[model samples]
Target chain A: MPTTITVTVNGTTRTNEVDERLLLVQYLREVQNLTGTHIGCDTSNCGACTVHLNGKAVKSCTVFAVQADGGTVKTVEGLASNGVMHPMQAAFKEKHGLQCGFCTPGMIMTSIELLERNPNPSEAEIRRGIRGNLCRCTGYHNIVEAVKFAAAGTGGKK
Target chain B: MVTMTSAPFEYMRPKTVAEASRLLSKYGGGAKLLAGGHSLVPLMKLRLASPQALIDLSGVGELKGINSSASGLSIGAMTTYHELESSVEVQRAAPLLADAASQVADAQVRNFGTIGGAVSHSDPSADLPAVVLALDAVMKTATQRAGRDIPVERFFKDFLTTALRQNEVLTRIEVPKLPANTGTSYIKQSNKASHYAVVGVAAVITLGADGVCERARVAITGAGPYAVRAKRTERMLVGKKLAPNVIRNAAKRAGAEISGSFNEDVHASAGYREAMTQVFAERAITAAVANAR
Candidate 1:
């Protein structure tokens, strides 16, 4: 049976009727027209579908939309306020953290989560923190630098 | 990527443990419980598990949280790996569990995956099975009428299978606190891609007043059909000091102590797994002895 769920996405409340088996990633991209969260792997190997569920990073592809009802979800689109980008997003752009930009959104989302947990993380900690999210662009060198830069509090105007 | 999604199934979100048990009884084998959905959802996407119904236990309040006492600790099955990894009680009571939980998959998976789901799934390569087995933990389950406790030894029957009946739901895990003068460790060689153990060893050793081993428990995973206790190796350590030579000789017996044939998969061959099991077993026991009070 189709269920009507209310999920607060990017600080905005959304009520929609979704299929019982619809994945949260599919719902965010297709139903809500929020295409920022990319689906890289159907299996949970690639972390391109990373998003925050009640403040913790989780794979959206593996979570059903109905299961997230009454939950607060934070996607890549929710990071920026007004027109200013989040520090993690700004760091990615400043450090050239993208090649094809396919995994950039998920990478940025996951990095912000890492920074939140550990305000200042070591290089090895950054690598382990974002291990779940894979960037096919092979730009991990720059991505790691971006996270460190954001952690330093100089990556963006704070 | 293949457009793999779970098959259509009825979803039931039960608010209470009793309700969840009742729903499982109503659906029987057709129902699969969803804890974190980290393991099951992937199988469903690959069409390996096509349940006619899914009983969502995410909303069950009674199945979430941790309670500790002098005897042991009772952890709600729905508690996430992140919670377990960061828990001070878990770190102090059973560091083997916290250490193993931290190694499960990655940050995202640890944040969502629950210890209960991992135990119930009974994946041989999973880190928790061996850790829980070594800890002598007890598995608690609920049904429509009664609740029962099963030891870790009998709880795991085969690969990807448990003693949980169709009508039962695993509610919590009771892990006895490691005794004084005891130390434990869980070490594994994880596959880079999936982070599943190639060969994992969990050991707990309680040292006697004279520094000789009083009790020893060792369990291994990834090299067999299911995680098995290294009884031969454990017996060798029971009354002896953890000398380097004695530990090495005992570790060698772990490869032969397993009951079934070694698991040979794309990541590792049977012979390689056997060799690594011996190496990891030694490493785990040495570490445990070093930390023993």
Candidate 2:
């Protein structure tokens, strides 16, 4: 049965009727048209579907849309404001953190959570922080550098 | 990308533990109690689990948070790995639990995966089972019939199975505080792909004033069908000095003590798991002893 869910996404309150089994990532992509939350691997291993549920990063594919009812969601689309990139996004671009760019959104989302936890994570902490996220390109070196850049820019207090 | 979705099911969010248990009892085998959904959701997407109804426990406030009593720490069943890892009480009272929870999967999964869900799911390769087993934590559950407390040893029955009845909901886990002069450690050899432990060991030791072993508890996971107590190993160390040679000889008995066939997968062969079990056990016990002093 389809159920009605009221969720706050990207600072906007929206209500929609979604199927009971519709995944949070699918709802974000298809219903809200928030395609920035990529679904790289439906199995939840790829971490490309990472998003903030109630202010914490979680695999969107592993969560049913109904599960997010009355909760808040933040996607990569919500990161920037007023046509300006967030510091993390700017750092990614500045550091060339992405290669093919498929994993960038999830990487940035996961990295945002990582930075929130540890504002100035060492290279080793950065590697362990993103163990759930996978990037087949860029060898993760640039991503590590991008996180470092963001940490330095923000004084590690994100 | 694989567009896998769970099979359609009715979903209900109950507000209280009693309501959740009643719903579970009413639906019987058709209902699945949803916690953090890390384990169930993935299985559902894979079509391995297709419950007709899902009793969403997210709305049940009764099953959340961490509390400490003289008996020990009482962690609500829905408490997430993130909460466990960041909790000062957990770190102080059960550092091995914090160590194990911190190493589960990644930040995203840890943010949502609940300890109750993980323990109930009883994944052979999971980190908590071994740690809790070593800590002698007690599991509390509620059902239409009654509420019960299950020790860690009797709680886990087999691969991916627990002693939980069909209509029961695991309410919380009660872990006792370690005694003075105690030290604990949990270490795992993870399969890089999934981060599931290939061989994980958790050790807790209490030393007498003289520094001889007053008590020792050791548990191993991933190298067996379920986390099992390293009885022979514990027996060896309980009253001994825990010297380097004593630890090495006791660690070797961990692999030999398991009676069943080891889990063999692409990540590791039986022989490799057997070898790693001893290696991890030795490291975990040694680290625990060092921490004890």
lDDT of 2: 0.91
Candidate 2, residues A37-151: lDDT per residue as tens digits? 9988788898999999999998999999999999999999999999999999999999999999999999999999899989999999999999999997745999999999999
Show how many residue pairs clash in every candidate, following the order shown: 0, 1
**Candidate 2 lDDT over residue span B1-293, tens digit each:** 32547788999999988888899888878999999999999999888999999999989897999998787899999999999999999998888898899999899999999999999999999989998899999999997668999998999999999999888899999999889999999999988878889999999999998889999999999998988899998998888898999999999988766755788988898988999989999999999999999
DockQ comparisons of all candidates to the true complex: 0.68, 0.73
Q: What is the per-candidate TM-score for chain B?
A: 0.97, 0.97
* Interface residue Cα RMSD of candidate 2 after superposition: 1.9
Give candidate 1 misplaced runs (Cα > 4 Å). Answer: A154-158, B1-4
Over B136-207, each residue of candidate 1 has an lDDT whose tens digit, in order, gives 999999987899999998998888989998888899999987889998999999999999999999999999
Task: Identify the leading candidate in terms of TM-score.
Answer: 2
TM-score of 2: 0.98
RMSD (CA, Å), each prediction: 1.9, 1.4
lDDT score, residue A12, model 2? Answer: 99
Q: What is the C-alpha local distance difference test score of each model?
A: 0.90, 0.91
